[model samples]
Target: MFNEVRRRRAVQRVRPGDGRALKRFRWWQLPFRALFYLRLTRDDGRRTVCAVDVRHWRNNSSGNVKACLYVDGRQHARSGLPAAFPVPGGVVEVRMSAFGLKRCHYVTADGAEYQLVPDGDSAEGRRAHFDRRHPALSRGVGFLSSIVLVVAVFLLVVQLAEQLTRADGVSPYVGAFSSPVDLSAWGNSVVGLITLTASTERALRLRHSWLLDGAAG
Candidate 1:
């Protein structure tokens, strides 16, 4: 019920876009821009191209960001973050996270889902390319990221537990406890930085976990 309401509000944010050509991704926009593409052939034997473009830094100015949908290179429709744009036989869903995009998929009427391909010049595209070029190394890096996030989450839980046990109201019920992996302020800072990098790396692959990326974000 709650999810249905949120979906309706998100649909309400959709607005028709004035036909404008989509711009090519540039090197300077690497940190702020993300672009993805989908190609489909109709029953009539006609090919169509769909693109999803987002500019992350704009949220800093307006506190709200939007996703733009393009068809065959021209703007088709747009909506605020978490957009759902209707296309030929499916809806293109775009979602953002604090670090970058968490989702960009095409869902067909029959429930089939597919991730759109990132623009070749974008960071996500480069990451995908690396995965293809160096499958073994890529898997190793991905595994390392998961390990880092898991350790970070565990430490976080331990610290929270210790803190809760120290509270006066809770101390009597659950005696004072200390974290086994104690770290100084500087050490904590380093861990925070490492976890942030791990989260960003995972984001590039559109991999997110509520307990991991959520806490990092």
Candidate 2:
């Protein structure tokens, strides 16, 4: 129910584009931009390619990290984060997270969802290539990232709870609590770095959980 409401709201944010041509992805933009493509062929021998272009690094400054929808290399529509662009078959949903894009899929009328393919030279594209050539290795890396994120979230929550009890008069009401897993100052910094890396890795695969990746974000 909540998800449906959110999706509807995202759809409401969509606006028609200005008919600008879709620019080519440049190598210098690799670290901040994400580009994906979906080629769909109609029964009439016509084809349209939908492209999702997101500029992630601009989110903090503008607070409007939008997804640009391009059809056949021409600007079609665009919207803020969590965009739902209407296409022929259905809607192409693009959602972002603090680390990177967490979702970019073509959702069909019958409720099926397909992830668009990332550009071959993009970060996501390289990750996809890795998954194809080394399935086991990919799975192993994903598993490790999940484990690291879980551990980081656990420690963060425990430490936060313990500190909250330290406020004046708060300890008397809630009783002082000590974190079972305590880390030194440097250790905490290291954990933060690891959590960021783990979240980024998961982002590449569009894998995210509110509890795990949410904390990192």
Top candidate by TM-score: 1
- Please, what's the RMSD in Å of model 2? 2.2
- C-alpha TM-scores of all predictions: 0.94, 0.91
Q: Note the clash tally of each candidate.
A: 0, 0
Displacement of residue 136 (Cα, Å) in model 1 is: 0.8
Evaluated at residue 49, the lDDT of candidate 1 is 97
- Look at candidate 1 and tell me the lDDT of residue 33: 91
On a 0 to 100 scale, what is the lDDT of residue 64 in model 2? 80
lDDT of each residue in 1-217, candidate 2, tens digit only: 7866787898898888888998888888877999999998766879989899998865423478978899998899988888888888788889888899999999887889999999988899989999999999999999999999989988988999999999887998999999998899999999999999999999999988999999888
Model 2 Cα shift for residue 154 (angstroms): 1.4
For 4-30, candidate 1 gives per-residue lDDT tens digits of: 466567667789989999999999998
**Candidate 2: residue 188 lDDT (0-100):** 93
Count of clashes in candidate 1:
0
